[model samples]
Target: MQKYLSLLVLACLLAFNASAQQLRLITGTVKDSLRNAGIPNVVVRVKGTDFLTATDAKGNFKLKVPAGAVTVEAIATHFKQKEIMVGASQTTVHITLNLLQPLITDSEKNRYIMDDKKGLSEVVVTGYAAPRIASGIHIKASPQNNTEDYSPINENIFHTATDQPLSTFSIDVDRASYSNVRRFLNNGQMPPADAVRVEEMINYFDYQYKAPTGKDPVAIYTDMAVCPWNTGHQLVRIALKSKQVDTKDLPPSNLVFLIDVSGSMDEENKLPLVKRAFKVLIEQLRPQDKVAIVVYAGAAGVVLPSTGGSEKSKILAAVDELQAGGSTAGGEGIQLAYRIAAEHITKNSNNRVILATDGDFNVGPSSDGELERIITKERQKGIYLSVLGFGMGNYKDNKLEILADKGNGNYAYIDNFEEARRTFVTEFGGTLFTVAKDVKLQVEFNPQFVQSYRLVGYENRLLQNEDFNNDKKDAGDMGVGHTVTALYEIIPTGKNSPVVNWVDPLKYQQAKIMGNQAEVLTVKLRYKEPQEDKSQLLQKVLPYSRQQIEQVPEDFRMTVAVAAFGQLLRNSAFKGTATYEQVLAWAGKARGEDPEGYRAEFIQLVKKAKLLDKE
Candidate 1:
């Protein structure tokens, strides 16, 4: 018996030693080939196993995997996924990923063919194939049942500064338009004119403006230079940056993920992508934070009750088990989510309902007006709404924008996994945490120095002149670390401008130049604290400058490129000489320190646009 026990012990020891020898620590770095910079938040996984880790801020990662020949995978947002094989003796590895090139999928080609409503018949070109034309450009058309909706935008016309000196609008922080347009471009089609919101595209890239130095939570910066599109006109760039909150200082959150699992969401990019996006947000939650999963299809139901963030396993399981089917009852789902949020509302906590959907509400008060009324009423209860639009064919951009606007919230369209990472991981605070509510801007131009001016973009966000000061009127909200950018093209006094029409001199009242000659404009802003009912006022005076466009900051030039790109896409009457080639040139030069490669991606989009325009 003793000899037999000794033999068993010897066998067990040999097995344990072999197991230990099979494990090895692997260290590696992930890099972007285009920018030659390390990429943060990249997922490194040992293929065919559950061992996974993420790169740190510097793109460094370490993980233990079985020794001997093994396969590894690296994945990141906006970049192509890559795989590498490691030899038995290797302990260190390096991986480089290329940026994803836009490709026209079969579904994208079919969307164009199905859209007979866009005045496209069954006409075929001699050189083009059934689905793809040369250079991968597909003939632009909407699907017959596309059901996609965009609000019509009448381009803002040049205003006579002497006749209308004040331009008032709400500060919009939503950047859905940029991503939506990107989706269209990536699909090898041009987006409808109404889908290109110029201000949103300009605000999409972070300008890294200086944060607030005063007690206020927001800071304003102004710059003026010769307009690139129209050399005769000067462009005024007004930027507002909100104070950044440290991760440790972020308030505990009470979040309800209102996910749409309707039949329309059955596509891989719809409900599945939403689940993946929510997982990213889940990774950011703290022990004090709580999240609930509320899903809607035929009806709304809670798959998981309010659970502490520490129970991530439980939450993830609930999310993974969700399936998509049935008609969308978005209104019911919203009501349930808000009720759940209100029940667990914690004082001083960030309470919000994140609605992830394609904005297809087929049943129960789905009209834009009805939905807006619902969101507006719920917003008064201290529960904010953030809309995350997913999918494409039947995307209801118009309805989603209205829900966000009325709910005092922000909206984003997640077209791919990279965008999902950007929204939920890279921009966690700005997408979810509100810093200032009811933010409004009023620019009063000096007629002495300006002949005519036009506020670019922000057609829907325009507010009445008196609405700027009315505390009761609700406006847009700014999130933590959010930056709002606005542009105004001004024709300097005595300059020949094609957009401006001469009018007879005022007969009854003579115009007088009362303000300082150097004062080009006075910008008045109003904002309310997230929990406050009353608003606070802030103002700044802009001094005139003759700075040329070439002398301005790289960020300013980058914004000009984006704005011009937007105008060209929209075919604006006031686009002047803006061309896709010019946009590419300006953007290429201004792609500074593009660690995340967003600006670089913008340049690629311009290249695609230039090619598609030729088609």
Candidate 2:
């Protein structure tokens, strides 16, 4: 017995030693060869394994890998992926990646580049060279082939205050448009006019608005400044800041990852990016939280049953196993995911179905109206839906927007891994946890202080004035740590404007001026608690304290700059004197306390847009 025990211990020790010997600590830095600058957010992965880590802001990464002949791969946007083989003795590596040059196409026509390594067909501007198609690769042809969808937006026209006193809209917290527009500008293409939602663009950055000190979940703030675009007009900025919740204080989450593994998702930025993004979210989960994964291709089915977040390896494995193939059955997948969420529903828990897709629903109940109806019915079960749109070319923004709006959730477009980090890490609480639902805003302009007003953006979120008081009416949801902003360009009561043409005195009943003379406008907000059916009302009056554009707060100025940029992108008729140069100047001055560098990146994007506009 003693001899047997000694042998067992020896055997275990030898096995442990062998395992340790097989592991190697690898460190590396990835840099742009042309610019000699470190590349950040580059994915460095070990081939044939799920071992991957992104480079930090300085392009440095460290990971453990199995010893022996190992293949290391580095991938980043706008850079050609590269792979290197390391021997068992190798402990450090330096990788250099080449930037992809824009294709010079003839007649300004669309050009394609085949990324064989990622099995992706990337679209680029104006190229004459023949596309190099990989052998043995079959690209599927479907009804929704290579065409992106966006809902048309007719820019808001000036409304006379006496003729139309109330301007109502749902508060949009979704920042998908900014990232989507970034994607277009990054790819050297001008985005469609409808894709530029100015309200969303303005709401993308964090603003240091005052936190709620009352019982309400959101605090309201108003700022009045000389309009940067139209000097004769004033820009009224309405800001709402939701209460912040720490990660440790958040409720236990019951999450269902509804992933679209359709053929259209085969691109590197689609299925692979989805898997990587979910991994980021999975790391944020606690033992008390649970996650279930449901993938849809030709049919909808569960890849992993509801499992505790402690079993992260298992959930990650399920996500990694998902592959893109067959047709999309998005509607069926939605039903299955919501059913799982409902079954596991608990009181005071954060229950949500996160749908990751390119928004291509071809096989089952694919129309926007049909999917909207299905989501509308499912949302009543207390299960919210969050749509993370992936990929381009065939992206269906219109459908995704509708699903999120009607399903009482938020929509975001994940154009790259950095965006994935922002969505899942920096804004984790705001992305997955909802604090208030059906949040609507109704602004009553004081005819005494304002002549005509126009909502700067949010064309799609505009609601009838009656809908503000309707408890059953669906609207946008406000998440923890969310900052929502809306800008209204107003021509002061006596200012004559080219845009605002007064009708020869109202033939019908004219609105009586009754508000305080010192007030610019009265803003009313309605919202419901996450688990409540009834809505609560909050109101605030914007005092007529107009400040010069230079004297307003930095946040107010930054938001105005963003709105102007959006209008420039859309080429709106009301974009009075709003040049890209003006946007750059205002944004440069107001780009304050950008810890995340989002504002700096916005400035860079504006520079790019200026060049593109000239082209």
Best by TM-score: 1
Candidate 1 TM-score versus the reference: 0.77
State each model's CA lDDT, in order. 0.81, 0.81
Mark the regions of model 1 whose C-alpha exceeds 4 Å error after superposition. Answer: 1-141, 495-511
In candidate 1, list every pair of residues with a backbone clash: 114-144, 115-142
In Å, residue 153's CA in model 2 sits off its true spot by 0.5
- Candidate 2 has its poorest 10 consecutive residues by lDDT at 133-142
Q: What is the C-alpha RMSD of each candidate to the true structure, in Å?
A: 26.8, 26.4
Each candidate structure's TM-score, on Cα atoms with residue i matched to residue i, is 0.77, 0.76
Candidate 2 local lDDT, 1-615, one digit each (tens) = 999999999998997678667667788898877446666656677764434556765678876677687898886644566899988889999999874433333343333332323222333322212122111011221122366766656456567787788999999999899999999889776675667888889999999998798899999998898887768788999999999988899999999999999999999989999999999999989999999999999999999999999999999899889889999999999989988999998888888999999998998888888888888987888888999999987888888999988888889999999999999999999998898899999999888888778898888889999999999999899999999999898878752232233233478756465646798899999999998999999999999876789898899889988999998887654576889999999999998889999999999999988887742
Query: What digit string (tens of lDDT, one per residue) describes model 1 on residues 454-534?
Result: 899998889999998899999999988999999998888852232133233357545567868899999999999999999
